[model samples]
Target: MTTALKLVIFDVDGTLVDSQGDIVAAMAHAFDRAGHPAPAREATLGIVGLSLDAAFPRLAPELPAEMHGAMVEWYKEAYVELRSRAGAAASSPLYPYALETLTALHAQPETLLGVATGKSRRGLDKLFEAHDLGRFFVTSQVADHHPSKPHPAMLRAALAETGVEAHDAVMIGDTTYDRDMALAAGVPFIGVSWGYHDADDLTGAAAILRDFRELPEVLTTIREAAA
Candidate 1:
């Protein structure tokens, strides 16, 4: 039986947008400014679901534990500057049919939609407003209060704000961190294969979708099973 899901919480970075280029570039600058050699852009891209603060540890494994905070601070400053000028949303563009899929989901009366993303509230606001997609989400869980991916805080908070139960909620994300969080939260996960993380990272997801157009049917299957 497919899980009946009332709420669909999406992770912003890999799930909604292919934010690798901007994120990698920004992190490169941050690492350089911190006097650490920049890692490969692909390496930086792998941590897309993580918060700026959360991403620090992944990239700076050799940095002293105490230096993590300082590194995060510097990264934020550098990334913010990049976000203001040019971000991934500006470069890579949304996955094909991404907006159309969101529109279809929004039209479903039974579907309560929101975001659970590593993006800062301000940053996501800017991106969504630019794309005119901000109004679709009833509420958003930004990186501010939430612990990084693999932590369910963002999903929990978003669900709380929407008054949705974990059993009735599903998290749609493109990375393992995102799926891991959903698994930890006991919510069904919908893995999107087209994002920054490869298919391997989405192993825990209940199912995978090749395209956004498949989502409405997926939701329908879940709802029918839930019924």
Candidate 2:
């Protein structure tokens, strides 16, 4: 019998690249341009996994919807401009062993890798290009294509694209948004502590990983347990 596919979906920003500095900077720039008080770094990081539409409003609830929309656009523009500058990519370093883990997983015959992230397709493309990492993912569900996380749309799309059942997939991320989304999708969820979200926030994950090297083993364990 053919072995069933095992799909591993990841959250990109905090999970793979340490892009929090650029993210925080862009958010602050947006708020300043919009003539609003910049949100604290903690508040900004707390919403990292959400799409701009869902995220901006949470950061500035008192603002009119129009202002939130403007802030979103400003944030995007600032982020893109920031990325275009020299040395900007260095601000977001890939976590240690992140590429190694992806390479190892991609080399496995039955393993398929995917990304479910709040990043726009353009942003994700830049990240992939910067690290030469696009080849590792078979599917990419980005903010431009799906509802904000804590919603299951991105995960569902990844599973559909891979022809992998929910039970056979694992979602690896660094936030409660990732955990809640996986739970809602009925996929196994693994939490990585080095991401933006606190370890305590990942209480619902099947396994909480402290190191990127622990990923393959965690995936194996989750698959076996599900089987």
Q: What's the TM for model 1?
A: 0.90
lDDT of each: 0.80, 0.90
**Which residue pairs collide, candidate 2?**
none
Error of 1 at 145 (Å): 1.1
Q: How close is candidate 2 to the true structure, as a TM-score?
A: 0.97
Model 1 local distance difference test score: 0.80
Model 2 alpha-carbon drift over 4 Å, by segment: none
Q: Write down the TM-score of every candidate.
A: 0.90, 0.97
Name the regions of candidate 1 deviating beyond 4 angstroms. Answer: 1-5, 87-89
**True-structure RMSD, every candidate:** 2.9, 1.0
Candidate 2 structure quality by residue, lDDT tens digits, 129-200: 888889999999999978899999999999989899999999999999999999999998899999888999
Q: How accurate is candidate 2 locally (lDDT)?
A: 0.90
Best by lDDT: 2
